[model samples]
Every structure is written in structure tokens, then in C-alpha cells.
Target: MIDPRRLRVLRALAEHGTVTAAARALYMSPSAASQQLAALEAEAGHALLERRGRTVRLTATGAVLAGHAARIAAQLEQAEADLAACSAGLAGEVTIAAFATAITEVVAPALPALRARAPEVRVRVKDAEGPASHRLLADGEVDVAVAVEHPGPLGVGDEQVLLHEPLYAEPFDVVLPQGHRLRADARVDLGALRDDPWITPWPGNPVHDVMVRACEEAGFRPRVACLSDDFRAVCALVAAGTGVSLVPRSALRGGLLGSASGGVVVRSVGGRRPTRRVFTAVRRGSQSHPLLRLALDGLRAQAASLAG
Candidate 1:
């Protein structure tokens, strides 16, 4: 019979790409991981992994098995959660993935309160770009993920819409150093930036697409001056006069440079609004998990001011 534990070990090995890495992620010794995988292979009567120079990669069959393993692991985790809920306290670890602002504004503030009330529940965070963040959720790498839902679609799973508050209602702005030539105008016409240097994120990132679409709507292609996944770094580059960025006013709290701030300015296009609609997401089937529910409730309460 195929042992679930052995399948899990193989799944970890497949997901991590190396026995040593899988062992580290699973919190087991490399030898133990190898042993379990060996046993699983023996039970399955086939070669699940193929050897490379110093590592192993999943075979086609192994990849299929790993997908099943993920579903099983999720069900097992939910089962454990249900059992834990029957006890006196909420207890379990939940990994969360979120974009930059949510980590600082929403997650940081809400965690302390949530932890105090449910001391048994442990939370960890993985900083991710929006589209990437949702993929992490779909991959079973995290329990919850927070992201903005603007032109790019978010996950179709169960969601707790947090920005039900009015953080702001304005067009996204072009941020630059305090003394750029355009700062004088409250809104710069997009056509004027046809030849302007721009800083943006990696191609697949949510913000990168946002910039592209915004520029497209403005009837021009942005001349990308730099590539950075770090939102802070993107702003720093803008502050250093390296390039200009389209950022939400909220993010300006950290990225705007003084002299550069006066020089660089956010300008709204005639009718184009480059804005993000932020929300909290949980697996639709996972609402029964108390930790997920409570965290959403706390997020709602904290976001009351913004959602309004």
C-alpha cells in the first residue's frame, strides 16, 4: 500500500528539487528524506525521480503524484484544523503571502492583535508581487494571500474584501525626485512622457502590467529605464532621478524623496486611473478554518477606516 507519509516525502523532494533542500523544508535529515523516498518508490514499483549530477528531478509520474500529494496535504491540514478547533484554543501555523503595502499597512498591524487573542496560532509571511502572490496561494504554499484587484484579476477563491474603506480615490501618480521638471503640474499629461525614462518591475509582476496598461491607455509605450522587483527600490531610483514611477499615494509615505518630491509629481491622465483594488483572499473551501476566519475578521475591523 502507498503510505501517505512516504508520498509526502516524495512530494517535498519534488517541490524542492533536491533531497537536501526537501529535507531542510520538511525539517528532517537528508538521510531520512532519502529513505522515505526510497520506500515510497519501492511501494509504487516505479522510478519517481531521475538522478542528475548531484540532485534528482521528478519524473512525469512523480510530477503527477506530487500534484495529488498537494491536494492530500491540504485536506490533511484542514482535517487537523477541524480537530484543533474542537479543542480549547485555536492552534496551527498559517503562512501568508502579500504584496508590499499590505505587509506594512494591513498585515503588520493586524497580526499583533490576532496573535494576542489566539496565542496558539502562529503566522508567517512571504512577501510577493500580486499575481505571484495568488499563484503561491494556488500552489498550496500559503494559507492566505493579500493583493490588489485592479485591471489584473485576483484569485477566484474565497475573499475578504478589506479596502472596503476609502484609503484614497485618485489617479495613480508619476513619482519622481523633488526637483524634476514636471513637479509644477499637479497632473502631467501622459503624452509628454513618451520619451521619459521609467522604472518598472519584472515583466510578469502585477505592477509591471499596471504600468504597461496605464501607458497604453495614455497612447504611448513607456521607455522602461530600469527593472526592479522591489517597490522601495523602484521609488528610491525615482528619488535619485534614475527614473520615474507610477505609485499609489499611500506608498508615497516611504518612497518619495524631499527635493525630488518637489521636482517629481503625480499627474493624472485625462480619464485613465491606474489604481489597485486591494483585498484579502483565502481558499474558498478553507473558510471552515478558524484561524483564517479570525484573521479576516481582524482585518475587516482594522480596515474599517479605509473601507469606508
Candidate 2:
């Protein structure tokens, strides 16, 4: 019989593309990882990897075995989850990954309720973006992931082994200097800022994509004056009268606005407003685990409260 541990090592190698990387990910030394793969090859009676210069590629048999390995790992995880569900008490740690704002607005607010209802269940939180959080969920590194969904058709590659539950839709508001001409208006038109310099989130961020798309829909491209990953810094830049920006409403809460440049003012965008849908994702079969279910419920409740 093939050892499940060896199968896991093989799968990790396939995913990470190198022995050293796989070893680091799995918390093993390179020599031990190589030995495990050798043992796996002996069990299968075939070579599983082809080494060429500095990189390693999986052999045909390795690819086939790795696919089976993935299914086996998922099945084992589901079996464990099923067993956990049969227990009388809900007591376990659930690790969740989410972005910065969601951590404050969604996850943190739900903690009090979670503690009250399930004192035995502990929650661990990690800050991660959409793609990174999804990857962590797929790898079973996190029990749940809070991610942002943008506007567009889902691609074939977007299919995941996780279950998704929609939480809430958060609107984006324009942030401007107090002295800016549009600050006096109750609702600012995005097109009105066509010629104004913009301070935008870095590329590859979901918020940045939303901002760019919203501007394009308004019949103009944003003239980016600066790029920042931190929304607080973006707010400060706006307060400094450097450039205008769009920020999610959730970020404006929790003293973030109070600490920002006093010269900053927020206004809603007129017409169709840009919004990001926040969703919670969990591993397919583990969603029913008592601890995970409790956490999910708390997250849903918090989101509903925010929406209300």
C-alpha cells in the first residue's frame, strides 16, 4: 500500500515545482524529502520525478499519482470532519484568512458573539488577500477565507474545491480633500474627476481593479498620481491634498477615518456605485464541522449587521 505521507510529499512537489520548496512548505529537510520520494518510487516501482538542471518536473506516472493523492487527501480530511461532527462537544480551533478591512469590520465584530456561544471553540485569524486566502483554503491551511468578489464572468479556472457563502456587499466612496470643489456636494459624480489626479490602490488588488473599472465605465481613465497598498496611507495622501481616492465604506470605520488627515471628506458616487461582494469560503466537506459552522454563522451575523 502507498503511504499517505509519501503521497502528500509527492503532491507538494508537484505543486511547488522543486524539492527544496516542497521541503520548506512541509517543514522537512531536503534530504528527508528526497528519501521519502525515493521510498514512494520504490513502492510504485517507477520513477516519479525528472531532474533537469536546477528544476524538477513530475513524470507521467507522478502526475497521475499526484492527482489520486489530491483526492485521497481530501477524502481523508472529510472523514476526519465527519468524525468530529459525531462528537458531543464543539471544541477546536478554526483558522480564518481575510483582508485587512474585513478583519476589522467582519471578523473582529463577530468574536464577542462567538465567544459567548462557543467558549470552547478558538479562532485564529490571518490577513490575506482574495487569491492568497483562496489558496490557503484549498491547501487546508485555513478553515475559512473571507474574500472579495468583483464584477465579471467567472472563469473556468475559478472553480474551487471549496464552498462559498455570500456575506455582504460593501460600497466604495470617493475620498477627497476638504478644500476640493466636489467636497460640498452630497454625491460626487465620478466623471467630474476625469481630469483630476487619482491616488489608487496597487495593481492586482481587487479594490484597485474595481476603481479602474468604475472609472472606465464613467468614460474616462483615472490619471493615477500615486499607488499604495495601505488604505490609511491613501487617506492621508488625500488629506494632504495629493490626490483623490476611492475607499470601501468598511475601511472608514474603527478610527481609521478619525486618525486620517482632517482635511479629508468622503462622498458617495452618483449613479451606479462600485461595490465589492464579500464572501466566506470553506473546504467542501469540512463546512459542516461544528466549530467551522459556528464561525461561519458568526461571520454571517456580523455581515448582516453591517449591511443593516
Candidate 3:
């Protein structure tokens, strides 16, 4: 009988054009690839490859086989995905890749409600910025993603919008160590901290880029004291007096504050505005998932409470 593994080998050889390259991609040695291809030919009872100079070319039979193999490969993948999605007893995982602020301020609150509704559903998180999350969604690596839009500059990519929540009307105040000298002021001016080292998110994310620009607009370059995309960690560091940070106003409202405290104060900067806009994204057709819809409904309800 023609084995699917052999058919896969045949497909790979056709796609890559050489046993050497195909073997490397398949993580097999060239000799192994050749052996497998020969075995496949024997099983199929036909010539699948032909010599063209030092290279090989697919015969007409090979082309016909490759076509069938492609369909077979797709069906196999889809079958596996469906089985995983359906077998878990309210369990199947729904992975979410989100930008820093949304996960910290928005999604964090709803996790408990999600688990309560479908205790079997395993929710996983990834750090994917707004534009990049679309690629992950398209590729099927993540089932949901919470992305951000920075007011006028963001393009929504090809992502389907699920929920949009205005978490903070403006960007957060720069958190200072508790009992820091500036806490006494009504709102410390950005000019004072211009020379201070700042704790901010890493690059390739919106928050990092926004804070950097917020500082430059304040007329002085900021010294980034620590870098991370984790919201809780950022707060912990600030509480530890590691360095100051810019945080969303919503940070003041959640468990994100934790027990960590350093008598941190918050203040505003001048020039470029500090607030950011955020959006929730999922695959264009993914709302069909029962849990995905429930999750979004819970999110919107909680957001309305927050907004009020």
C-alpha cells in the first residue's frame, strides 16, 4: 500500500526540487531521503523522478501524484485541528497573543470569568504587537489577539475586529517610587524627569515606541532603566524603586498594582500627548467559536463598567 509518509516525501521532493534540500528540510539525511523516495516509487509502481542534468525533475505521474498529495496533506492537517478542537471536554485551548497594555489593563480582568464559564478551556498568552498579531492569527498560531492602535498612526492590518475598548482616555502617568520627592507635587512636570532613567517596554511593541516619543516631545531624551513587556513586572519594578515608568491610568485600578509598593507617584509630561488607543483582534471568521463570542461579550460588559 502507498503510505502517506511516502507521499509526503514525494511532495517534499517536488516542492524543494532536490533530495538534498528536501532531506535537510525534513531533518533526514540525503541517503535517507533517497531511500524513502525509492521505496515510495516501488510502492506506487511508477517512476516519480527523472534526471535532468545534475538535478531531478518530476515525471507526469509525479505531478499527478503531487496534486493528490497536496489535498491529502491539507485534509490531514484539518482533521487533526478539528479533533484537537473538539475532544477536550470544554477544555480545548484558545491561545491569545496580545500587546502589553491590553493584556495588562483589559484582558487580565476577564480571565477568571472565562475560566468560570468553561473551566476546561485552557487560555494561553503570547506577546504579539498589533500589526504582528494579524500574522499570527492568519498563520493559526493564536486563536485570539488583543492589539493596540496609537490614535492617528495605526493601520488595522487584515485582522477582524472583535471588541474595542477605550481603556484609558490618555496614556498613564509616569510612575515614581512611593515617597519619592515628586509625589508631593500635584502633578510633576516631565521636564523634571527628563534626565531620569525610565523603565519601559521592549522594542517592536507600541508602548515602547510611544513612551520614547512621549519623552522626546518633552524636549529631552529618556534613559531607559529597564526593559520588559510584562505589565505586572513593570509595576513590581517600579514598586521596588528599580526605576520610574509610564503606565496607563487603568493600571491604578487592577490587581496589576499587586502588593508591590514604593510610594510611587505619577506625573504628566509635556509636548507630545501620552495617551494610546487599543483594539481587540481575532481571526476574521473566528467569532464563530462559541467561547470566543462569550469571551468578547464578557469583555465588553466589563469595559462598560470600567468606562462608567
Candidate 4:
């Protein structure tokens, strides 16, 4: 009989494409993960992994087993959910992953309400970006994830193991230094800032992609003077008269910009304003669990409050 835990490790290895990455995601050391996979191979009586130069790939048999592992994992999740439903009480722990801004504006505000509504249910929060959070949720390391929709298809391998619950649409705003010419405008036009130095997120960041696309639509590329992933740092740079940046309105509301000195102003972006859809995701099988449902309700309430 195959150990379900070993099957899970194999599934993680399949999903992550590397022993080190899978081990980190599973919160295990590389040696332990290797041992588990080796034990799994012994049980299956076939090799599951082929090591290349500095990487590992699934063998033919490994791929087949991975498919079975995914189904078994999903079935196990369903069983757990069914058992939780039998109890019909919000008494278990629910882990959530979210980005920084959402942690402050959505999850933090929802915590008090969740505690009040279901004192027996414990909540754990992990701060991560949308893609990373979704990866954690997919790997079953997290019960739910709060994430933003990017400009493409969702999830690696297109498995659709997670179901989304839309929360709110967050619009981007332009952050400008005080006394800058653009700060005088109620809504800043992206084209107007084409010649100005820009402060934006690093390359490949979702927000950076949004900024780039917004500028492209305006018919020019931004002259990025500085790059930082931290919204607060972006705001601080803007406050210190370094360069302007685009940030989600949610970040401003969450005190990212407010914490910066008074040398910056936020304005709406003119012409087809860019926005990201913020949503919560849970494994399809576990969405109906009492604890998950209660926690989702708390999140929905907080999102509604933010929208209002």
C-alpha cells in the first residue's frame, strides 16, 4: 500500500518541478523529502524521478502515478470536508494566504469579526503574492488564499483545483510628489508623465505589468527611475521627490501611502483606469467546510465594508 503522505510528497514534486522547491513548500528538508520519495518508489516498485543536471523530472511511470495522486488527494480533501460537515461546527483551524495590502485592508479587519462569530475556529495568515498564495493553496499548505487576478489563464497545469470567490475590484491610482505639476490635476494622464522619471515595481511583478500596460495604452513607455516591490517604499520614494508611481487604491487605504510623510498626493489615472480583481480561493472540495465557510463570510463582510 502506498503511503498517502508519500503520495502527497510525490504530488508536490510533480507540481513544483524540483525537490528543493517542493521540500520548501511542504516545510520539509530536502533530505527528508528525498527519503520519502525513495520510500514511495520502494512501495511502487518503480522509479518515479529522473535526475538531470541540477534538476529532476518525472519519469513516465511517475507521471502516471502523479495523476492518480492528484485524484487521491482531492478525494481525501473531500473526505475531510465531509467529516467536518458531519460535525457541523466551525471548530478547526483555517490557514489563509494573502498579499500585503489585502492583509492590512481585508484580512486584518475581518479577524475581529471572525473571532466574534466563531471563537472556536483558529485562523492562520500567510503573507504572499497572488501566484505564490495560489501555489500554496494548490499544494494544500493553505486552506484558502486571497489573490488578485492577473492578465492570463489561472493556475499552473490548468488543473482548476481551486474555486474563486470574487471580493472586490481595486483600481490603481497615480502617486505623485507634492508640488509636482501632475499633482495639481484631479486625474493624471499617463501620457503626460511619459517624460517624467517613474518609480515602479520590479520587472515581472503583476503590478509592474499593469503599470507597463497602462503606459503602453497611453502611447509611451515610462522612464522608470527606481524599482521596488514594497508599495510603502514606493510611496516613501514618491514622498521624498524621487519619482512618481502607480499603486492600487487599496494600498493607500491600508495606510501604505499614509505612513509616508505628507509630500505625496494620490490621483486617479485618466483614460481606461487599470484595476485588479481581488478574490479569495479555496480548494473546491473544502469550500463547503464549516470553518472555511465561516472564514469566507468574514472576508466577504470586510470586502463589502471596504467597498462601501
Instruction: Summarize candidate 4's per-residue lDDT along 1-308 as a digit string, tens digits.
Output: 99989998888887788899889989999999999999999999999999888778999999889888877777788888889889855687989999888889989889988998888888999998858888888877799899887776555443536788798887899999997997779998889998888998887567888899899999999899999988989999998888888999888874566568487988998889988778888876777777888888888988887663
RMSD (CA, angstroms), candidate 1: 5.5
Q: What tens-digit string does per-residue lDDT give for candidate 3 at 1-308?
A: 98888776776676566888767757789899889888988989999899777778789998788767756655665565455557544556777777655666567777898889888777888877756675565434677766666433332223122234443344567788885667777666677787666889887667777777777777777888899777668877887777788886666665556666444565664444487666566544455456666666666655555452
Relative to the true structure, candidate 2 reaches a TM of 0.90
Model 3, residue 273: distance off in Å is: 4.8
Q: Could you tell me how far off, in angstroms, the CA of residue 114 lies in candidate 2 after the best superposition?
A: 0.9
User: Which residue pairs come into collision in candidate 2?
Assistant: none
User: Where is model 3 more than 4 Å wrong at Cα?
Assistant: 1-94, 99-105, 111-132, 150-170, 236-242, 268-273, 287-291
lDDT of each: 0.70, 0.85, 0.68, 0.85
Task: State residue 170's C-alpha deviation in candidate 1, in Å.
Answer: 9.5
237 Cα displacement, candidate 1 (Å): 3.8
For residues 16-104, what per-residue lDDT tens digits would candidate 1 score against the true structure?
A: 56899778767789999989988888988888889888878889988787777766666666686687678776877888787777777
lDDT of 3 at 67: 67
lDDT of 2 at 132: 77
Work out the TM-score per prediction.
Answer: 0.72, 0.90, 0.57, 0.90
Residue 302 lDDT in candidate 2: 88
* Deviating ranges (above 4 Å) for candidate 1: 16-21, 27-31, 50-57, 91-95, 112-143, 147-171, 176-186, 202-205, 217-219, 227-233, 253-263, 277-286, 300-308
Q: Alpha-carbon error at 242 in model 2, in Å? A: 0.8
